[model samples]
Target: MRYLLAGPDDYSLKQKLSEIKLSLGDTALLADATTLFEGARVKAAEFKLTVDALPFLTPCRLVIVTGLLSRFQPAGGQVNKASRLEEADTFSAAVRAAPPTTAIILIEPELNRRNPLFAGLADILEVHEFPVLDRSGLKAWIGSRVSLCGGAIAPGAINLLAQYVGADLWALSGEIEKLRLFAGSRPITEADVKTLVGYTGEASIFNLVDAVIECRLKPAVESLEALKAGGLPAGYALSMMSRQLRLIILYLDLKSRGEKEIEIRRRLGLTADFVWRKTAAQAARFSFSRAAVAYRRLLETDLAIKTGRMEESAAVDLLVAELASGAGLETRELS
Candidate 1:
């Protein structure tokens, strides 16, 4: 039968894709559009996705078609607005005539619920877009997986990881396996989780923030080292910080407008914990004016790094110093 797995949660899509792979075992063939994205521009990548859910009815199978086909992969050449419109019309038609299969995969840029895809589906399992798994849902997902695998990741352990890992299921699951092997039959502990996975796994993007938040400048520097060693590019790392800070500013702005947290999410287009993280980051000790100052600093440094005036590693160092000053961590350092 045909399937339409469309949702705002990309991680959900990735997780489902992973599950499909697992269910099909080692023998099933998988094809996805992500590979083509690297070599082809948006308009030039000709993609019409169709897979016989049973490529051959003789054996149990899983045929997957990802949603990346509809997305842009950073076009290298000039505009072809005319060709794009034509492609959209063609793509829309293909979605209407989906084939039957034991399973079909859809993902990214969620299908419009009001659109025809939703109406045509035999079943639509509305997966909660879990960038952060709630307590109940966390137990359910982890519990079920444990039952399937004949072991548990433990509820307490799951929450501890969730505090840092959030809901990137793959990373959480990876850490779980690592912990499971380390613990064996013994119950997993937070210390064990930390000792094994450490902050590095869930820590890189946010380590500097935590360091800044807690006013630990030296740790921020060390975090810079860890992030770099972890193969996170300097510019991309700085960009993440910029995004966090700018989002904080946006959250604060909406909060000032008497917006409820949910309203802020709707207005800002932010997910739940993202909104919480921003509020938590900017709420205490730093006002909008202070955040604005820091925001401007990030903007300037981002440009300077892109233009080669400052390297991102050095920029992160400077930014941390400024944040330390902002949070009243060590004002004398900048002076």
Candidate 2:
């Protein structure tokens, strides 16, 4: 059987691939198109394919191709006998003629429905791009991973991990694994994560907020540069940093109403640890009005980004500088 699994959701596609490969037994031959193409100059001396190469793909033979037709060839154009594509056609034709025992699995392939490969394949599987998980997916995925590891991910810890990791499943899965080892007989706790998992930039974006909240210029600048260096998207940097500013503003508004940390946490649906840590940070640093000003600038940054009035990265840089500068720059031009 021939198969194609292609999309931006590489993590899930990879998981499905692992299962499929295990099902294909010992006789499978896995060959990547790029690898073979690169090796073809040397390989041509030993084994050359002709129209006769088609029958060689036997049952249980697994050949993997990635980015095969996307960047590699022209569709329905006149096939030049001299080109690498013609060579690919020869291999593909051979696979088509082979028995059902042969499996051609393409990984993250970029083939159009109109392409020749589409006509040749017996089966097609479409995989979707995994969106950033919202609150519900986070809880379920954490619960599942925790159960598999012989423990439970505490209810309170979910929000801490969610706030800290955002929705990057790649990063979250690894963190969950580490917690499993550290967990032993203990239930996962926010303190355990603080000590073990550490504050990823996802969590530490708040540090930059706290820095700006305190108006510590140097550290705020450093934090912004660190996020950019990590190749964080300009929109993402602004969003996360902006969220921290808003959190401060919200915490302050509630605090003035004589709301205690626990009450504030419950009202916001914040996990206990987040409310304690974040509220304490707010109390130590900001007044409501100052936080409001910072948040408005971040809101402006958000607008400029969405409206395309400023280029994405430049908008983030400008906002970071504005936030980092200790003096209130609201009276000055931001853009």
Candidate 3:
């Protein structure tokens, strides 16, 4: 059997891969019968050799290749075009001749249908494309996943979870498990979702960054406390804030260069449209000098936490206080 699983929904793709492995029977036997390769670097001859190898005390062998298909994708515009063409030819020939007892799985990002690699295999194997789910689909998926974990979620809580997490199943799946554990035997509530789901952390970290950048000292401290109360760890909160600052710095640089939002988003590899918009809005609030100072202070705080000079929780609070109060900035806007 040959399988091609391509998608942005990596969570679902991985789940499918796990299902395939589990279907192979005996977890202990998997190590023996399974072979893996980094497809981008692997030679077709080497892949064929593994695929031709007979199963060890099993009916079939499992082989997985990732990132290889991208080389053959038309829009990829991969370097070494001739090498990729030759590699695609090799793969096409080898896949057609693969042994019945070997199961080959190709995992790649979205590929063009016109690409010869996929067009050739379209009729020959099981090919599934997993795209990002829409809002309705995401909501249904969350409810189903909650039940799968032996927990029930209220509809209101479901809506709240969907609204906060968006359509990223990869993040939503993890958050669901956390909510399940936090809920225990009680039904999960909207309030519980707000408390335990990290949604508050996700939403408020941006506010905290804005408050700090704007020198709104009181709101910055309050935002940090609210995040901590919502079950976001000090280290996690600090890390998130640092990420926000870094994003702002990058956004400022890009805008200064007159780069458009779409180009900046592509450069940053940020798939979430709202995130890019939020970062842009935040970046607009700070001058380059202020953003750079905040970034430096963030690094100092991180180092202090690492060296054990300050506890993780206290370091985060102090970091917020200093940045909000403009301690490290020459401009030092006293609010």
lDDT of each: 0.53, 0.59, 0.77
Write one digit per residue (lDDT tens) for candidate 1, span 1-335.
Answer: 33444543445665666765565544434332122221122222233342323344333434344433333211222233554545554544443443433344444333433333233342443333333344467556655655555555666766566554544454556667777778778777777777886655335665565555546667667666667777777777778777767777787677555565567767666565544543433343245665666667778788888798987678777877777545542222222
Instruction: Give the total clashing residue pairs for model 3.
Output: 0
Root-mean-square deviation of each candidate, in angstroms?
Answer: 13.6, 17.7, 12.3
Better of 1 and 2 by TM-score: 2
Candidate 2: worst 10 consecutive residues by lDDT?
Answer: 32-41
Per-residue CA lDDT of model 2 for 154-191, tens digit only, reads: 78887677656644455667788898788878889988
How would you encode candidate 3's per-residue C-alpha lDDT over 214-258 as one tens digit per residue? Answer: 688987887788788778898898889888888888887886665
Candidate 1's error at 262, in angstroms? 35
TM-score of each: 0.45, 0.46, 0.60
After superposing all C-alphas onto the true structure, candidate 1 shows an RMSD in angstroms of 13.6
lDDT value, residue 88 of candidate 3? 77
Task: Single out the weakest 10-residue window by summed lDDT for candidate 3.
Answer: 73-82
